[model samples]
Target: MNAKPTEATLADRHVLYQESVQDVEAEIDFVQETFQALRGRDAELLREDFCGTANTACEWIRRGRAHRAIGVDLDADVLQWGIDNNLARLSAEQRGRIELLQQDVLTVKTDAPDMILAMNFSYYLFLGRDELRSYFRNARLSLKDDGILFLDAFGGYEAPMELEEPRECEGFDYIWDQASFNPINNQMTCHIHFEFEDGSRMDKAFSYHWRLWSLPEIREVLYEAGFRQVDIYWEGTDEETEEGNGIYEPSEVGDADPGWICYIVAEK
Candidate 1:
């Protein structure tokens, strides 16, 4: 006889997403190290655009008393969840240094931050060239004169394929479904699904309708938005393991792998 199916909860989805996708500590470390290398000083203020649960912002504040973070998103419910969960785990002083705003990233105004991050490819939600350029312009304006914008992007031959890939985690199977792709416009629809051990599954727990932007397109927009310089950080492959070593260095060329992710640093 088969075991009974257990329905997963929203909390389960969040936990799985974080465990499977985010490395907040590593991300902050990269931001700090990269900024120091470029500017000869540490970055103090950070703005995480499309912050979702604000995990990155929470980690940013935990770095030091001098560090302050701002998380901007349009989803009030998700922002509240971050406050209740991630923020609640921080010390009062650390929590005091972070702010969450339920506002559009393009229109929200704040003090110029030393670094602005758009990780997880959230900026892909802007499907039009005009909208994306507008966003880059707004982001540039929100930064200090020496500030840098950090954005992550993924692409390769496999990205446009309509297929689902599953990886087994500790308690569940994480599924990345590429539901549909339109080659004409580069519009792609993707979803995140989870299957539990008890045969229960959550389909489309998170869905994204994005226009896959190429690296050249993104770089041109950033330049048009008034960024003084744009640099690409390519991940290094480990010789022993034949996998990404989590070490990224500035590069002008990247390998033609089946799939890859890299960071674009735009200086204002």
Candidate 2:
């Protein structure tokens, strides 16, 4: 007989997702450093688009008292979970600088921000070209004149393959499953699953149906959205392991790796 899922099991999904998937600190560092390098000043306000669990928002507030963050997502449950689990842990002053909104990223309006982030390939959810262009235009409108928009993209030869890749974390196995792909439409369906030590598993803890936009396509769309400039930040590889070293630098060309991730920075 199968065991019944407990409250703890259900609750563990977000925790595991954070530990296994996100690197909030590194992401923030990239945003800050990139903004400073490009704009020649520090960024004080940040907006996180599709900010599930608002982990990046919480981390942003924790970085400095002068920093403020607004996190926008359509899911109220996840936003509340972020407040209870992540935001509540911050100091009152830190918490005061953060706002969580349960709204669509495409239409939500807030104070113009110094930086807007759509990380972890969340923006790929907009499959239609016009929809994506609309999003980019909206993001541009939501930013200050000198603000920067940061987005992450992942692709390579193996990205469209129907395959499952599993990596063992401290207490669980994190699995990335590419369930389906369409070459004609460039649409893909992916899922994240977790397996516990007891042999139990949380299948499809999170799922995404996204169109994999190529670099040229993304650049052209940003240009059409009125971004004055768009640049790609490529990650460096380790000498021995040949894995990403967590360092990114502005580059016009990227090496052909089986799978890779890079950042696209758009300036208004």
Candidate 3:
């Protein structure tokens, strides 16, 4: 049997309420700012697919008077987690501007949005061409004429096996784990495990089964899905920056680095 979904699954209210809100806030801001730069205007409405805790949605509201966001996911528990954890930080005015729905990205629909983002490589869950194409179609139909889709991707020859990386949080240890890999199929099992100072551990705080998609395949699918253009934003090499230097410029080709992470933006 498949491993039970992570506690970070959308319906898990307690975990969402307990997640790192500040880190999430920065990520949402980065997306919004990037979208604004791409569109040459402020993006007022955002649709976040595979939004687990809806923390991004909450941040969108807190950032401005005009912002509004809708978070979509199939799990209900995690959606409630956002409400209990992240939403509580917002004022009543901000709360009204954000909404979370338990729905699948494969079927969810909304008005033409100024921008759409599927962050943390969430779209990788669809391992088949047809399923992924259908998702791209859904995203296209949901975007405004000038809207853009932003997605994150990572790749490396060394990526096809088990790996473990750790980060030290303020009072806890966070682990990003790639426990297994199927090289023949590119299907992998991964998760995040958290260790608190008290020595208690939350194994599999978040886990996912995803197909590792390459840059070329992503470009081809975007074109086939009717996107006007697809461009990449590559990460710059500078070990000095805490998060590493990244620039969101237009590029048709990426570097041949052993491992790389980048974003693909598809214009509608």
Candidate 4:
């Protein structure tokens, strides 16, 4: 067996997070609900795009007994990490049922599933209309006859700008920093940094260079890609705190906000 790599110190955090199945269930529930809402049926097969560590794939398996999942990513290191971390949490049957592959999601050849989920803004890695459209088309092709595609998107009035904020987690702090945003074309750059006890700090652990695509624009692309329908699941703020309370409800009143996050579900 290969030795485990040392946990990166605060100064070096390319591995910004070590997620497991539970961490991804929250997102999977939203994806599944959105798919059912549109198709009027439950999804059975799920394909996870850019499935780093395959956390969501493992979680999908647990959502129901009939559920199956395929996790596709280009990084073999994280594939192995998933086997080491997330896959262990699965039952023997679930472990054998789910499949994890290391390949470019854009070119991967496999059977279509009921739904494809692109979570954590992973699609943001692609920075062009043509490239993104190609990916969306590929996703459509990779879906089962009645499958849908689900993606989580975030942006608002002031998306392309440098900003930093911290959140409290169970034991550590989670920080999402908007390192740069360009108003000219909605090109944006962001980073995830972590601060630990003992006054240790890690900066620029993981960076993303993404085109800040709008809801209408993405929906248009989904329609162009042949999806029969597209729906937006807007985020709801906590009544008392006026902060995003982590619960998302289906709605079309997706308006501008200082910062907002929501899901876009497309049906085929």
Candidate 5:
């Protein structure tokens, strides 16, 4: 008889990644509430750039009957996986309200949306200032006249360090490896790996070669891209535990922790 498969061997990287790296529920909550608070109206259409697996887009569709989402990505396989797994779980009406476009974000054209999301630090892939700015400009053009762009960024003293951090997950261990970094260019190579108790490992399940952009730099580029305003939403600290309290508010200052993640909101 054939031996049983280890969890790592049987696991799907996309599924594991969704479980470990993404919280679409919280993300959508922030996006929706922030947009309504900033714009004084509910946002109807949302565009998700570099939307792997279209998880967030699906979540947006499920939020309301009028809510619609467009997910754009260059990876066809991942898009298909999202259709098969994530989208498949949605009701037919929900699926109809969302679209997954296998197209490049910089050039893809679609109906103007009320907001555009470039989350998961995916835009970090643009290594050059000009390239990154160009992408931002393109994103701006794809939005409504009063549209807003939402992006998540991460950094701190430890961002450029070469290190590996392991965290316990449901049935396996997730490891984030900062495999390499170059301070002079602010470029880095990072990867995610999964390990199972059965002594099996899924190495390099996801890898990224990205620039470590600073908040000032990102704000400058957004302004250069013609955004009327930009704000950094810093996470609040839990008074009791002194950890992030899961509430992010617009702030001009943030703690210089070893590592941290924050959101950038740019209004057109």
Candidate 6:
């Protein structure tokens, strides 16, 4: 009899990423509730920029029958993987409500959406201020008059440190490696690795060379991009555990945690 393959060899990185890195349900909940609170109305159309597997777009479609989403990314292979895996899981009607475009996020144009999402710190890939601002301007211009753009950012004292942090997942351990950092330019190289219980490892499953952008720089860029209002939604702390409570609200002040993630909301 033939020997079985190791778990790492048999596993799909995209599936692992979705299970460990993404919480589409919570993401959609935050977006839907926040948009309603800010705009005082339900948002029908959403566009996800740098949408890797379109997992979040699929979630948006499942949220409501009238909801529609457009996912934009430059990676055709990833988009195809999404169509084959994520989109396939959706119902026929839900599948019809979403579209995946293999194009650059900076220039891709679609129907004016009520909101756009640039989550997962994907915008950090733009190293220069001008390039980042240009992309933000395009995103703002692509939105409807009353549209809002939502982005997630991460930072703190540990953000620039070179280290590897691992968390136990269901069948594997997810590892985040900060491989290298340049303090002068705030550029960093990071990688995601997976370790299976069967003594198998998948190294550098996903890698990124990104600028470690600060909240102040990001907010200023949004203003320069012509967004009328830009707000940072800081995560609240749980009184019991003193950890993030999953409740984010607009705030002018935030605690200096060792590591932190917050949302940036820009209104056009």
Best model per lDDT: 6
* Candidate 4 wrong stretches, greater than 4 Å: 1-23, 237-241, 245-247
RMSD values for the candidates in order, in angstroms, are 2.0, 1.9, 5.3, 4.0, 0.8, 0.9
lDDT of 1 by residue, 201-233 (tens): 898889999999999999999999999999999
lDDT of each: 0.93, 0.93, 0.78, 0.79, 0.95, 0.96
Better of 2 and 4 by lDDT: 2
Screening candidate 3 with a backbone cut-off below 3 angstroms (N, C-alpha, C), the clashing residue pairs are 10-77, 10-78, 10-79, 11-76, 11-77, 11-78, 12-77, 12-78, 17-85
lDDT for each residue of candidate 6 in 1-268, tens digit (9 for 90 to 100): 9889999999999999999999999999999999999989999999999999999999999989999999999999999999999999999999999999999988998999999999999999999999999999999999999999999999999999999999999999999999999999999999999999999999999999999999999999999999999999999999999999999999999999889999999999
lDDT tens readout by residue for model 4, 50-106: 998888888889889998889999989878888877898899999877998898877
Clashing pairs in 5: none
Candidate 3 least-lDDT 10 residues:
8-17
* lDDT score for residue 214 of model 1: 94
Q: Candidate 4 has what TM-score?
A: 0.88
Please report how far candidate 6 places residue 1 from its true position, in Å.
Answer: 8.1
lDDT tens digits, residue span 54-99, model 2: 9998988988889999999999999989999999899988888999
Models sorted by lDDT, best on top: 6, 5, 2, 1, 4, 3
TM per candidate: 0.96, 0.96, 0.86, 0.88, 0.99, 0.99
Prediction 3 TM-score vs. true: 0.86
Q: What is the alpha-carbon lDDT for the whole of candidate 5?
A: 0.95
True lDDT of residue 193, candidate 4: 72
